[model samples]
Target: MEKVINAALCFDGNETQKTEWLDAIFSDVDRHYGYSNSFEKAIETTAGLMPQAFLNRVFQGTEEQQNRRSFFIRHGGIRRSPLSKIDVTDLIAWCQQRNTPEIWGLVASGIMLWEKADANENGYFLTTSAVTFLEAAPDPEPVLHAYADRVTPSGWTGSRADTMQPRADAIAELSLHVRQDISDAARSTSNRLAMEIERERIRDRQRDEDREQRFE
Candidate 1:
């Protein structure tokens, strides 16, 4: 709201509207009020992070859940458009339209739940960890940056050119995660095999012990 009020001075609104709405900003401002340099940068930095924007649009009750479920039925995994994909046959790209690979990776890692009725028919329906992740996110980044910049200030800097380096780094990090996920899946399979072998050996030993005790 404070950002909106200040931005209006340079952007849009009548004299009366600006005069009245200027009060929407605090008469006195703080460091936090000037967190982002401008509105455009603020929107980009805080994508899917604003609870006020998200909560209002979120599905609430059974009827609304069912309403959204119908859309998921038509498409897959809340992905509204198939045209955005690199190729329509590229299932991963299609899925990435809404939920990133990290979200799907978490589900694949067994930290969350997933289901598919068919090839394109999917339900991501993961809640508990998702709720926790959402709650923990908003508390840190701004505060951490503020304190970290005591010597050299670099608060919310989406407006800066340095942001491009971070973006490239993020893509590189995500690519590494793909390999990590593959290794994790292979480890899970190997561990499952080891578990079954142990169980079979234990069963054999127990059976032999029981037979010996019967003879005694």
Candidate 2:
């Protein structure tokens, strides 16, 4: 399942680049992992349906993050667990035990991030690129960690569907966490401005009152 997703994302990236990236990841799966089960091949066979953008994002992140760990990773994205729904902590531990390198960790983390990133509310569906990237991922642990550090829930953000019917609700859910942070900031600024204006008005009113009282 995850491999299929990785394939989908790989199909989304630059075709020439993806060819090289996929070759490396699949080679690793076959080498150290001993996975000759054609799972990777299945993804390659179905590359036509995948989105290029999602794959590009996956590759961009995977390549950049892998380099940070000094791993000259050829694979464009992270690796993933064989199980569709497995424990991330356990998965990470498993990778470490297998003598997986730091670059492998980055791939794992990228997969996790893609899985958790915003998807369509109606279908929970990701773009073809995202699916391809997931399919190509080597492991899931490092990707999860990187996601926590870099892409985890931040302040408010939005997307195109935020305004529509079904998405309005999802948009709210998606935006609320971040939106509240922005709202807090806006409210603090508004309060300060209001207070300042009120203080000036009060001071002016008091001066007028004092002058009138003195005239009498």
lDDT value, residue 69 of candidate 1: 26
Q: How close is candidate 2 to the true structure, as a TM-score?
A: 0.22
Q: lDDT per residue, candidate 1, 1-216, as tens digits?
A: 435534554454476764443222212112222222333322321222222222222123355443442232222222221112112122223234434333332212211212222466322232233223322322222212221122111344422323223222222222222345433433443344345445645666787789899999
The prediction achieving the highest lDDT against the true structure is 2
Candidate 2, position 136, lDDT: 32
Clash totals for all candidate models:
0, 40
Query: lDDT tens digits, residues 74-154, model 2?
Result: 232234322223233433444444464554444343333332234543322222332233233353333323322322133
Model 2, which residues run further than 4 Å from truth? 1-41, 44-90, 98-108, 114-145, 148-216
CA RMSD, predictions in order? 21.2, 17.2
CA lDDT, candidate 1, residue 89: 24
lDDT of 1 at 198: 56
